[model samples]
Target: MTVTVADCERVQTSWFQLRSQVLGSGSWEDDGLTWANGDLMFPRVIDPAALARGVERARSEGASIVGAWLGLDVDPRPLAAAGFKKGWAPWWMAGPIDLGLPADPRVELRKDAPGADGRPPRAWFAAARQGGQAAGGAWAHLVDDLAGVFDVEVPEPFQRRGLGTGLMQAVCAAAASAGARQVVLNSTPAGYALYRRCGLQRIGTGITWWLHLPS
Candidate 1:
């Protein structure tokens, strides 16, 4: 079968539409967060100009900017031109429910929470011991299917280690196990190539348009 650009756009559009239905409407939200399927109208990181417009629009409609989103468009140029922040303000990775796979050697994969089997894990990790002395190794979490990813820190001293890959691998593996027909993520410029390495195809891209409260 073949797919067209319009098909892709529909998929993108519907994804956000679904998010809005399940979570909350992308209308004027007095609380500061609005949703449209998976497309976040408001997320965490705010874009000053567009955000101002968004807030105005929301306020005019009796809503407020409770949250903000950073746009992730297919064209990085537009985002750059808009001076939008490039990061995971929303969008996250998801896949098959129970990808019962091991967490490759030199790392360990385990359930993120106790009896989290049916609850859908927000995140998982492939951890390495902190040198028989320190605290946490490295970790990443699934912020649910609505938001793609939150953050991953390997620690300053832990840089250069292959730990990040292992952790991601483990997470993907679990997502696969969880019955996720596809693994999804709005990868950063740095991790974009890595997502390819891990077997995820670009399904759709989103833009975060936002307005923030004054500091």
Candidate 2:
């Protein structure tokens, strides 16, 4: 299915909800979303100048700045020219629900992994070795057909063992079971290459900029 602007909005709403739970101590308004704990702000469909203004405002308030843009068209040159450090952000990947990525038999799938307030996982997936020596994890909150894969990670020792792919497959399955027709995820710069191997296509790229502050 082709992703549209409205689809992006729906997925983004779900993302903000998931991040608010995961990031903790964050605020969301009509203008944008902010995670106070991470000092991150995600402005909605704003231009480079507006984004720069927000960064400047945050810096003036004694907060180090981290900013994110949702789609591929993002350009951080304005922020960099304004003095913020520019760096690569995660790539947004999406594909049909059945990515054909296999789930490793050695990875145990768990439904009750720890979550906010020790409550039952609203939506979570974990893949771990029997002895717990290696593990991979991913999370999401499904909104209709869009399964926003919030985050995925595997430890250094577990790298290249296909555990990361298993974790992704596991999460995609979970989302499908929960009624998702499509899967979406933000791939870390490192995981971007890893995820592409699973038949998922990079649909768009997001930009992030950071400014360090003196303690």
lDDT (CA) per prediction: 0.44, 0.63
For model 2, residues 1-215, the per-residue Cα lDDT tens digits are: 78654464467555665655565534344244443433344444455555555555555655554555444464545556766676666577777777686777866656645565875444756665735566667765567777777657777777787777777777778778868888777677677777677676877666666667555
190: Cα error in model 2, Å: 3.2
Q: What is the C-alpha lDDT profile of model 1 across 24-127, one tens digit per residue?
A: 65543334444343223424343445544554554554444333343343334433444334544333333332334446465666666634366665445556
Best by TM-score: 2
Output the lDDT of residue 109, model 1. 66
* Model 1 lDDT, residue 85, Cα: 46
**Candidate 2, pairs of clashing residues:** none
Candidate 2 scores a C-alpha RMSD against the true structure in Å of 4.5
Best by lDDT: 2
